[model samples]
Target: MPVKYNVTERKNLQDPQAAPKFYASAKADGEVNLKSLSKEIAGGSTTVSDTDVLAVLNDLIKVVSRHLADGKIVKLGDFGNFQVSISSDGAETAAKVTSSLIRNNKINFRPGADLRDMLSTLKYEKYSR
Candidate 1:
């Protein structure tokens, strides 16, 4: 009879492909899209269909607007909070405001406990020469 361990020995495992290269490629694509969007918006010569932009913008507006209207805080898992905070006096001066007006309603999401625990428990192994 032989003793069995739950953890697999490192010597029996295969090496994994590098993940950073994939992440860099994805990030580069996002940057390219942003630059193209900026150029189109600035040039004004290229006509972007209103329906396409409106659909995306409206979806975003609906999420925030609905949550605020319902007086509920919208929580996005792994992201931090969105809530409506009120200010009073209608004065532009920060010192003069005293909780009289519903000045801004925003979304805030605090990361869930499970996500925090998982992040905290992450471990890395170093390869020896």
Candidate 2:
């Protein structure tokens, strides 16, 4: 069986009649319901269950919270740093300075060399007239 994935497209907010834009604008400002958003993305009449989406988002939040509590920097592959810092007294001055205040019992994940190399190899395609 082939794997299926969801692809999203960006819509222009400047056009009010642009196939029901996802976000609200001054012309038609209203609350954005998840069901409507899901339906639009699903590209079908099938209704999306809220539980599934909520579960995935909750899991992600839990993972990030756990890592933060452990004083460990959660490094996403090819992404930036997610570490906690604090203010500390500087040696040169008597005033406190903001710096990386890594606490005890922390785990930090430095991106692997392969990940860095892959990120650095990104190239954009040129548009032809």
Candidate 3:
């Protein structure tokens, strides 16, 4: 199954008056939740059951969260690296900056080589609504 996408028009934020640019927006066929993913894993001739897979996946989430909270980066082998990033308001002086100045906190994911390589050979088809 090829990835599907639809043409979308987006306005350039830097130049609102400029002509809208066209881009390809991913058209999701459906989302595979943990249950579905676990079932797929169990479909293989492996001893691991879906329940055990789910438990491990759940623990992975918890472990990643704890590490990120501790100001540590979590590297999931070739999958990617996860880390916490912050957006803070600029202060006039370095001494005036404080934790309170931090406005937004987010998790950033950087795809690894395998994922990047997959994208380089990605196949897509136009999807109609």
Identify the leading candidate in terms of TM-score.
3
Candidate 2 global CA lDDT score: 0.54
Clashing pairs for model 2 are none
Compared with the true structure, what per-residue lDDT tens digits does model 1 show for residues 1-129? 122223222332354553322111111111334445545554674566545555555686688778877877767655545676554347777787665555554455466778778668755433222
Question: Whose lDDT is higher: candidate 1's or candidate 2's?
Answer: 2
- The lDDT per prediction is 0.52, 0.54, 0.93
User: Candidate 2 residues 1-129, lDDT tens each?
Assistant: 122233335567798668753432222224666655554545643564555555555686699888887777787666545676544444655344334432333334456678678758754332222
lDDT of model 2, residue 71: 77
Residue 129, model 2: lDDT of 23
Candidate 1 local distance difference test against the native: 0.52
Q: Which rank order by TM-score, best down to worst?
A: 3, 2, 1
TM-score of 3: 0.90
Error of 1 at 62 (Å): 1.2
Q: What is the Cα-based TM-score of model 1?
A: 0.28
Candidate 3 residue pairs in backbone clash: none
TM-scores of all candidate predictions against the true structure: 0.28, 0.33, 0.90
Q: Which candidate number maximizes lDDT? A: 3
